[model samples]
Target: MTDVVSEPTTVTGVDTPPASPARGRWDADEHGWFGDFGGRWIPEALVAALEELTVAWKDAMADESFLAELDAVGREYAGLPSPLYEAKALSEKAGVRVLLKREDLLHTGAHKIRNVLGQALLTKRMGKKRVIAETGAGQHGVASATAAAFFGLDCTVYMGAVDTRRQALNVARMRLLGAEVIPVESGSATLKDAINEAMRDWVASVDETAYLFGTAAGPHPFPSLVQSFTRGIGDEARAQCLERYGRLPDAVAACVGGGSNAIGLFTAFLDDPDVAVWGFEAGGDGVDTDRHAATIVGGGAGVLHGSRTMILADSDGQTVESHSVSAGLDYPGVGPQHAHLAATGRASYEAVTDTEAMDALALLARTEGIIPAIESAHAIAGALRIGPRLAAEHGPDALLLVNLSGRGDKDMVTATRWFGLDPETATTDPVGDPDSDPRA
Candidate 1:
């Protein structure tokens, strides 16, 4: 166990796509997860307003008209409820059962679509003509832009200069979707800076713009909002698991960047208690070093991004540099609900190192033929640890569910180069950081 932050707390192979193709129907009335978790913990100026918006969201989920509109948009435009697939080879290899909630197969190749779709629908209802968001990995930006295009709304995405260069293809994707991407060059020129710039923009233009955030952190309504849209993951997994295994999985696992995917999958099992839940954090090198975003394991309670949560910070409350192989999980703070769950000891948190995640990535590629995003590979790595434990402690037939948040297509350049495989030269084991900006 490590200090500073505080103490806290599977495998398969398959030729699964980055995300599953949208399928199945969603029960809109199952908003209990969002109702209990998402709430406004912001400035008084935004509190009552957020409350009203929550009321509308609740009403919308219940309104057959609103459900029909969302369903229509999902099918013809947004593509809702991506598939859940069983990782047969990988599960057999792991000596335990494993299933994947394929969010990567969405239109944008990530779970970001679930959130953006919900936010976009809410924006239209609020009569907002413009939407602004902040992104670290660019998945959110692409998803937001996709939603904006579908809704005919103007979208602006704030990204760190560093991330823009590292994820250049995503920048192009956002632009192609007709969203203006602003690269922030201030501060560390990474995620935190982009977030700061987005806050400034939101404060200045709060009247006609809705800030569609990317994760389950931030203030109230956001954790709730994003979760509402994302619960489709768990809902699908439950039925799929039952269909495949004849019972619920013994455990559910997902990578926790801002805790969106993990929360989405874990929400349904919160009351079950018997269905164990695990959230994996980025252990860049190791939690022993200051080179990870394992907030609940290596950080402390603090206010960040408009909410009280565990944040990686220095003694003076200034955020510290967080390092992780996955750009998506390299943030210093996490969602408030994760912080709450970690505190209450209802769930467990652990760290997955860069090497472990990479190994998991390779194993999946070779065994199941599915290439996972590096961020999600962390969860796969953690599942490897869980699978063996459950197989031994429970039974040889213990079932495990892993949320594959996104695909590896966006990360191939980095992954190939990180593992010393040169895509251009067709040489395996190439070296050096793949994120070096060609024009920098």
Candidate 2:
């Protein structure tokens, strides 16, 4: 962050070479469209605020002081430049050297902190005394709350009632961090609904409140803005890979919920054609079933949450309810950039079943002694699924860096039920057994 990376400028009309093919067409055009995906689609009243946010973000990106401040907060407060860990046992299973970007080890136990802190700084720059966001899995809500606490800003988070129940620990954690967590019960009682509620609140309070978007999926500036904050994941990973492996990774894998983490990693390597990029979506029961959050795989191009992108929708254009056991990935729409990537073949998108993600989660915990968020487990599962192919393409020493977006402590309850583990069931070993039944 010492030197900020500016967004790609639209070189249309009299464009000479189209912004160098190697650097990727990631910059939003003058209209803010990423290959016809991103745009500003909110009410007229919010236009001034959105434009103001965009200008502030662009100014901040161009400012050295802002970049240095962000870097300082990331390293000193968020424990950033999180290490790249080589998972030996996992590599054995995948037939490649599987490297994991250890964002799970970050200060808030998640990569969400990076973007939250950046946006929080923007809030201060805007002279806002309050911040707001909507979260599905609670990782973002927790991050927003933590940043608000640090800046002494009043924070409000909107979460679906269902997420409130599923991610109860995160709810408690957010409350403890001094955030007002409101549970939205409208619509499917999930993330999309919570987003609706949050937007409504933002429209009413934009003058004094900054809606710190949780993902890269929202309107124009957000997709680019969030990616700007998170590209550090790929920035650090790419450097570490070169230093460790003497070259770029053969592939990079990251889970796609609203597509922030995947875009974060993919941006660094988009210019490297040799390094394959994979984005895994939550398959829920399976993509073949009615339940899944496989936006790119099973969805069509549409607008949702203000941006034109691939979305889970019916024939009438109503957003369908997406299902994923991992609360983090249960979204109907993805970031516009991801849609563009999949459409243009810059990146591959696939779905991993809930069972597969869970298995991968357990495998990583047992092998690397690192428990990963179920959202990240989708990426782990994806690497396991595609590693052999990469080896065939790149050789036995093929490398893939998986973005471990967050720690699994927030998902223990779901894991306990999934694996039928009884907390009361004592094991002869210190590590409790997942198969042991307390009733026995």
Model 2: per-residue Cα lDDT at residue 270: 77
Worst 10 residues of 1 by lDDT: 20-29
- What are the runs in model 1 whose C-alpha is more than 4 Å off? 1-52, 76-79, 423-440
For each candidate, give its TM-score against the true structure: 0.86, 0.91
lDDT of 2 by residue, 287-393 (tens): 89989999999999998988999999999999999999899999999999999888878789999999999988887887778889999999999999999998888
Alpha-carbon RMSD of each model: 7.9, 6.6
Query: Alpha-carbon error at 277 in model 1, in Å?
Result: 0.1
Candidate 1, residues 1-440, lDDT tens digits: the string is 12223211121323222121221111112321221232344567665556666677777777778767777776666556677777877786667888888887778887778788888888898888999999998988999999999889999999999999999999999999999999999999888888888878877777888888899888765766677678778867766666555566788999998988887887765644467789999999999998999999999977787777888999999999899999999999888777767766667899999998988887777767789999999999998888888899778688888999999998888787777676567554343323221222
User: What lDDT score goes with residue 183 in model 2?
Assistant: 98
Cα lDDT for residue 6, candidate 2: 50
- Which one wins on lDDT? 2
